[model samples]
Target: MSTSWRDRFEKNFISPEKKLGLDEILEEAHDAYLGWLAASLTAFHSDFNEDQVDQLDRIFQGESRIRSIANDCYNYAINGRFRLAKDAQEQEQMNDDWVCLAILVQSARPGIEEFSLTVRGRPIGVPAKLEQLLFHAQIRALLDFSTVDGFDEESVSVPQFFSQPVPGYLTLKEIALLGQMSERAVRNAAQPAAADRLQTRKEQTQTVVDATEALRWLKGRRGFIATRAD
Candidate 1:
């Protein structure tokens, strides 16, 4: 009878004496978790928009609450604290949780759209694709924030262009190019009339100096010094 029981046990379980080491199990889990994270982030990135990306960048720049929520979800997924194993359901839940947290973090911003919008400016509600894109953008932003050194914590001020009531907007490519230009050169390139208008507006209204203005101001000062008599 004992021999028969032994045989049955061996048949039912291939490894009666051998067991998976904790480190080995954890390593496997880590690899799987990382894989899932990468795939999900990739899917999200494929459809992200500029606005959503900006929001995520802010969150990554050390928003304490956002960090906490994301860390909680990550810990739960990696440690298998909320599930028996990292299966499909677990992976989906982790992804969903991350998206939810990102939304919450972004919603905290002032003047943020209510995760809902229509192409025609009507209230059609937020689509799943948009939501996913926003979520992914936030992730990217956070990652960028983490890698960036010496980011300013204070809110940035913007300037109006062309004497218009509305603020000016620039394309990403334009902005990148502008960043490479010397401050003096940028200001020097601005039309004298436009520069005068900008100065007048600056004196009249309380506006935060933007990157462009900073560069222009620096250039102006340098030119003034160079032309001055010794």
Candidate 2:
């Protein structure tokens, strides 16, 4: 087996044709990480209602840890940190790097270290519910989210669309982020001067769009997936 993290990751995690420049790769990785988190919630909390899962999904976006992890892991592999795994221990360490990234990204809170199954650096008799949830979710994320053979049925796949709940009203920034477009683009589209302009209303100093109008405008655009609230 190849010991190099970069080589192993390239061979296992992504399809050859899907590889791109660093920036593009990182962008896709970030999107994929968030998508996975959102999609995986149901598996982690099967008994939880849709509202519960939606609430948890919102919590996942509270911190940008997943984006940070994607960048850090990409940089680690690209910056010559990946070494040839010559022995069992070395190979395990290489695997841990990926696992660590998965674990950290699963944190709903700002500081992942706070989720450590410990207090003041000391182990506890029983881990807290949140701690256990994050721990197991990370393991499942690595195993199921990866393109590795045996672990996943699909050898190659694209990031699937994950729906986020939309509020009755959204700021231009929120619309841009939710729609996977730029704020500039959203602003331009919302401008009165634009043809087929998106309808908007002002809230204090900020401009906001009605969710129904936003979706109507967005639905006509290429690659725009509709989001709903229950």
What lDDT score belongs to each candidate, Candidate 1 first?
0.31, 0.41
Model 1 earns a TM-score of 0.18
Candidate 1, position 202, lDDT: 43
Candidate 2, residues 24-126: lDDT per residue as tens digits? Answer: 5444444444334434543455333446534665776522554454454443222212123444565455455445454433332222223222222333221
lDDT of 1 at 116: 28
Cα deviation at 57, candidate 1, in Å, is: 26
User: Lowest lDDT 10-mer window, candidate 2?
Assistant: 155-164
Which stretches of candidate 1 lie above 4 Å from their native place? 1-66, 71-86, 111-230
Residue 100's lDDT within candidate 2 is 47
Model 2 alpha-carbon drift over 4 Å, by segment: 1-167, 227-230
Error of 2 at 147 (Å): 34
